[model samples]
Target: MEYCDGGSVVDLMEKRGFSTLRIGEAVAIILQVLEGLTYTHNAEIPNVRLADGSFAKGRGLIHRDLKPGNIFLANVGGKQVAKIGDYGLAKAFDQAGLSGQTMTGNVVGTPYFMPRQQVVNYKYTQPDVDVWAAAACLYVMITGYSPRNLQDQDPFLAVLQNDAVPVRDRTSAIPQPLATVIDRALIDNPDIYYKSAAEFKQALFNSIS
Candidate 1:
């Protein structure tokens, strides 16, 4: 493990007061995380064995837990780089056995960052889960708060009830287009949300351009 002298993004936010980051800096940090996910989601790894002693390669992995605390900042070449860490809840999906659904009765991931699908149907592996979580992270980065409107109600219940305020409504300083991108990524509809990390990255880039 590389030493991240800069510490977690959450630490930085706390030290400087959240929502103090410049738009470019916040977007750059988030793009780094998305870039990491682009590789993680597509990387091939060994799959678990089946009852028949048969096994296959898993083509996609989901980072069931993604939040500010899980993201580290390391100084690389005199520049700080955000890196995704903590794979404790990561799960792999077999491409050959992908039925668009996986069984799971228990909820995982931080409550504030979890997507509605994760709260409603814990039994499934979807890349969109990370996408939504990443957007939640972005919200915190830009607004100093969770998208769930934690000040008004319990964040866990808000997530379970799909009660999230639009990013634009939370922070007017954020560019409307960028806010829209984050909002769309946080959408509850997997079919309509950013489908892949690459797509999410592109949308983010477009927002800044």
Candidate 2:
């Protein structure tokens, strides 16, 4: 909370367009958020339930609902940091060990971040799903626009089922490598994308380095 700011990233973007940022600065902002989530998942969080199998951390604490509004922005003295806030209403659940499922309260994340299965009432892992939302947010931040146009009734379905537009189509300013990261994150194939925030953070830093 030390880096806390009273405004959201969307507020900043609207006031000052993101299209002007160089790819390096864009990666820097994204790396900060990814690293933060990675740290939390890697920490010893108390009372978090584990998936009955595999014994690996079950997506840590699944943030059931992550959206531009729920996200908070702060500057570690002008370096932007994002935190998953409003956990007061989210439900964390045990992850699938090797491959199994469990009950969580039936609710879709915000229309923009909501993944397809969630909209259809399918059970999904907490952290895995959280990774999905993070990926979506990443797209918005770098492009100054939502990846999905939000022009449809079922935004998640369109976003999830339809192939993602080429990142170049999304933004000429986005570098191909970083855009590739966002593309993989929102892709239909899980094996092609990072399953955890930690994995995504590593890829991001790799790009920067």
Q: Top TM-score: which candidate number?
A: 1
Q: How many residue pairs clash in each candidate?
A: 0, 0
Candidate 1's TM-score reads 0.87
Task: Please give the range of 10 consecutive residues that has the lowest summed lDDT in model 2.
Answer: 95-104
Off by over 4 Å in 1: 49-55, 95-104, 150-155, 190-192
Best by lDDT: 1
lDDT of 1 by residue, 49-132 (tens): 343447666677788789999999999999989999988677664443322223336666688888877777554557878887
lDDT comparing candidate 1 with the true structure: 0.79
For model 1, name the residue pairs that clash: none
**In candidate 2, residue 118 scores what lDDT?**
55
What TM-score against the true fold does each predicted structure earn? 0.87, 0.73
The 10-residue segment with the lowest total lDDT in model 1 = 95-104
Candidate 2 lDDT score relative to the true structure: 0.60
User: Would you list the clashing residue pairs of candidate 2?
Assistant: none
